[model samples]
Target: MTTPPYDGQPQFPPGQPGQYPAGQPGQFQPQGYNPYGQAGQGQGGYGYGYAPPGQLAGWPIRVGASILDSLIISIPPIVGVIVALVIDGDQDELGPGGGIAMVTGFAVGFAVWVWNRLIQQGRTGQSFGKKLTGLRVVHAQSGQLIGLGSNLGREICAQIFNQLCILNVIWPLWDDKQQTWHDKVVNDIVIRL
Candidate 1:
């Protein structure tokens, strides 16, 4: 029988239709050059493992959305405190440390929960809140999936305005790339759905 040409389409040689080249090695073709010319890999140009779709948002825009989300979630706990007051619980007798403790507990617990969710989602391909809101996180350095530490750092910084609750939210409003302190630390970003 005769072997078919490699250019047009795949055809079996002689009697076969799906046979490969007899001596061709396993798949190892070099990658084609990217069309977009940007910074070098170390400077932020696309390289290994970079997604085809690019990022979801710059740090500032993400911060805005996060601040918006935090306002929504934080309402419940505030309501709980308000309800306690409406019931006429002794405010002074609640103990001097009660407010501090509550703040600490909520901050710590919430941070930990957000961190775990972000890391898990990032590692598994979806941050908890991001999953609900239709967003995601990706690595900046390696361009592979990011982990908990970077994600936690990113989340904390992402909501700096929410955390500060007075004026930090406006910081991103002026930022050119909209990066908050956390994103600068972890070199990551949040993308939307």
Candidate 2:
């Protein structure tokens, strides 16, 4: 155990200068201060891709939104049909044309489709009913939310796909990653966007 020139002061070993002296880990020598070290590196905080979210909330959120959207959009047509019914009795009018059943059906269908399309078009990518229902359409490679043209493609497929015998709706279910058949055709995914 070497001692300092003063006799008992703790000193660094002959070869190790900046290292802790002796067995005392707390004893350190001088080095330049690192006040800015690791700056912007996020060492003291969450970095990129630190942790992924545990649960997916797409379906639940979209389902709730659909109910809300349906209720809200259905109001106009419902009111229109009621007014039409009172005015025309069995006639057609400005509020809605034809008998109550036909008028109501037309109004409801039109309002629903319009509202669905508008809302879907508002987001990062367009998703009609199924898209709004917790499923996102994105490019396969970039994993990015689809843009205008692709989104339009997806929306069109989704809308008319109702007639494709089950292939229309069931495609997403069969996808390895849960993408719809329409998604496959469009090179997209029904993922959490």
Collision count of model 1: 6
Prediction-by-prediction clash tally: 6, 3
Pairs of colliding residues, candidate 2: 58-134, 172-179, 172-180
Return the TM-score for each candidate structure: 0.47, 0.47
TM-score of 1: 0.47
Location of the lowest summed lDDT over 10 successive residues in candidate 2? 46-55
Which runs of model 2 end up more than 4 angstroms from their true locations?
1-75, 90-115, 118-123, 126-135
RMSD for all candidates, in order, please.
Answer: 12.4, 18.4
- Over 4 Å off in model 1, which ranges? 1-52, 58-64, 86-92, 95-129, 156-178
Q: What lDDT does model 2 reach?
A: 0.46
